[model samples]
Target: MEEPIRILYVINALEVGGTEGQLAELISGIEKERFSPYVCCLRTIKDKSSYSLDCPIIALGVSRLMSLQTLIGMLSLVRYLNHNRIAIVQTFFIEGTILGVVAAKLAKSVSAIVVSKRDLGFMLTKRVIWQLKLIYHFADRFLANSKNVKDYLIKKEGVNRGRIDVIYNGIDIEALEKKMQEVSGADIRSREGIPEHVSIVGICANLNRKVKRVDLFLMAAAIVCKYLKDVFFVIIGEGCLKKSLLDLSEHLKIDLKTRFVGSQVNPIPFIRMFSVGVISSDSEGFSNSIMEYMGCGVPVVATDVGGNRELVEDGVTGLLVPCGDAEKMAEAIQVFLDQPAFRKKAGEEGKKVLLERFAKNKMIRDHEFYYASLTKEKRMAFKKKRGKFSA
Candidate 1:
């Protein structure tokens, strides 16, 4: 009998977001017999306690976005990785990706350094592109979670297309099933203060300007509510734009139709509350919220952006409108509201796709295979050279 292969997953923090959620799911679903997973966050934030993924998590308390702290953190990570006899270093996000690669390379025990590209718009700028080019060279493998990200690295940044592999993000369809089942059991209308008579349109995300484009969603919500008086827009999750969107809704005299549920630690409850889910992002990697919505059998209308088309099938699964076009977005929302049978059919199709394509167990296996492939030192060296170093 052989000891389980050790993998160290590096990310920024376990805050409540898509990245954090996926990381937890990835670890929870990994085959424990073959792979023992350890997690390390560059910044020590709170452990997201929603799911019961009891994997050991390490955090080096560091200041946010400070280079000095990041560098110190990287050094600490190397020491930790080496001490733990970690064979594979898998990093996510920019800060984690850059530091994890160098730390893995520095640790002789680490057979390969893997950098998972979780965000498509990450390092999309001309200047930071140079940095990606530099740091990417240190990696033994570039695991892209979407074709959009893989294409960006190759076409946009001139990285080797051959080196990039599209590994779709996995979701717990079973947990999603549980979410849907649990929704029916709870008296959510009374608990959340949602009016039973009002039709709920839910958007589960951070109130950010660039990515989420929640302002546009609010504008569309106003337009939709004008025609549908019994409609109510529920914006779940909070950020800087919270106050701004609240003010805008008040000024438009549709504040009554809109409610900021604030940043929810667990969005499952709120997602289950909605009759339809909406995603109005300018850009995205794979959206888990939409997946969760679909799992809950809630129809969705999302913007046509990176990896969004992958999650949603227009006229089949859920409607996808052109990004930034609030009118089309609103119209799509109306389409779902108007045709209950169409919405239900689309939601059903989404569930089928979710079960077949985005299974959490499949995701864990893909990553395990990826980790095993990295064990070959020769392959790791080739990957490191082909990916190119930024600086």
Candidate 2:
């Protein structure tokens, strides 16, 4: 029997965010009999216990980008890849993509290099784009989480259409269902001092980045408050911009009805409390928050942006509005609030769409097939080269 292929996944950190959570879920759910998974972090992991993985995780202890430690870490990564005969090196985020691709190219035994693109490059600068373009030549394949991202790579970055594969982020429905069963929405509302009868419009996103456009959520919430007195707005997830967002909420006079429940390890309960789920991001690769909202049977009101349209069925499952248009967003939210039956039906349809299209098993199977095919092609190319030499 052939030995299982060894694939090393590299990332910036194991933080409690969409990218990290997706990585954890993929590694944990991947078929161990066919692929042996390992993880590498460019920096030290702060909370190792948060992820449940049996495979080894190596931290290179990189303190800064321009330091000698980063150089040493890169060399160490190459050595590890060569010594372990890594079949594939898969990288996430910018730092991981640049460093991992370079190291994988240097490693003699590495067969393939994959770069995961999860966002729309809203934060990338000209210098960073040039750097990424230089490194793109060494990578064997690119994994985009959405067609919107794939199109961006081809049209914006000059990548060939054949080189990119669109793999939508998957949700572990079983685990999500289990979490929903375990967590009580009533308990969470009580703890947060939210009244039982009030309608809740909520958003789950980090406030650190301006690209999330959380200000739009607050503005829309304030608009909703104008017509409805029995509604509350909730923001889940915390970052440096918390103070500024709070000030904005206060200025809008919606602070009295808003709850900023900081970062949550398990936000399912909070999601359960939402009468409507909202995503006000200026861009998205694919939103895990939208999936969570659908999984919890809560209808979504999202900006019509990257990958969002793919997940939301406009008038059927959820409503889509223009990015940065708070009034339009508020209008959509109001539509859901006014018609409970419509909201409930939309939520149900969203969940059905999620189950049919974005289940965990489907994602795992797709990845397994992709990895196996790449490695097989690599082996065939090597054999053909050897045959030519012999002839």
Candidate 3:
């Protein structure tokens, strides 16, 4: 009977990274009756991995930072927010949050601004950090993908602790189960020229040496190869460090056993192929791959960093090795490879954890509730100001 509350979801781009993928999933999951969602990408759609949502998408075609074109794009965003009378503006990533919050303030569109901290901000440049420090106070609320991220924002970036809310990433367990049933790991292995007898250890993350420590994963893989025969490794993502990582694999003499399956649109089949799932990141905000591994009944071996300890109970769900120790990582991976019963036990326990904590429906409900509550608070504040003016 009444008009739905309009919300704009803004991000740096509609690319296939974890943050972008989560944005797509969250927007797609929102109930249409309660909210009219719109998407605004700071850059043009460079890849085909974007979501085809029912709502309109406005791509500003921003390619460079701090350029004339970026300024034009920000102005365009401000105008759009004012014209559409968007009730809420939620942003992901550093670029989008900085720009989105600035635009929201400039437009004075009566919108509740929410920003998400999806990573540890280890990869953020100095310029972006400066901007964040300046504009973070303009945001009404902050959403962090993990408690680790929230603490980092508060302790490192000097953001108010009370303003940040920790929300773990969620997985669509039903959809994931359907995909796993539809695509067998053997089918994928056969197509990729991998032998069925080999034990596959795979990681699905953007290849970055500094952040993801993918080189460390490769090092561990090489170590595992010496003690265990008939084993293979797979890295399922693309990034700037691909060339160097490939070289490192060759240098380590594990090139023959490793496969770099560059950027997959649907990496679930690849993830399903793993005997062990690994997160070697130097830092992480809650790991989507860890959830995916557990969902597929695969045990994980992750470095004890970020929210990894939150998701994995060492020796229960999987093993946790110290960050940057290849020998320790190899030892943990070998434990799963050698003991089938232990792997199965750990995997089943991991699945139970996923079902109990990281379900998609619960995430969607939490987001919807947060949005509604913020908008209500904003409205009440506005009403109070109006009452004072009238009196």
lDDT of each: 0.79, 0.92, 0.86
Candidate 1, residues 292-379, lDDT tens digits: the string is 8887778889998888888888889998899899899889898888887997898889888988888888888888887767675556
lDDT digits (tens) for residues 49-141 of candidate 2: 878777989999986667899889999999999888898999999999888999999999899999999888998998989999999999999
User: How much lDDT does candidate 3 score?
Assistant: 0.86
Candidate 1 stretches with Cα past 4 Å from truth are 45-53, 64-71, 122-125, 180-187, 191-193, 376-391
TM-score, cand. 2:
0.98
In model 1, what lDDT does residue 386 have?
80
After TM-score superposition, the amount by which residue 359's alpha carbon in candidate 2 deviates from its true location, in angstroms, is 0.8
Give the Cα-based TM-score of candidate 3 against the true structure.
Answer: 0.94
RMSD of 2: 1.1
Model 2 clash pairs are none
Per-residue accuracy of model 3 over 289-362 as CA lDDT, tens digit each: 89999998899999999999989999999999999999999999999999999999999999999988888887
- lDDT for position 198 in model 2: 96
TM-score of 1: 0.90
Model 1, position 54, has a per-residue lDDT of 63
Top candidate when judged by lDDT against the true structure: 2
Better of 1 and 2 by lDDT: 2
Ranking by TM-score: 2, 3, 1
lDDT, candidate 3, residue 56?
Answer: 82
Show the lowest summed lDDT stretch of 10 residues, model 2.
Answer: 180-189
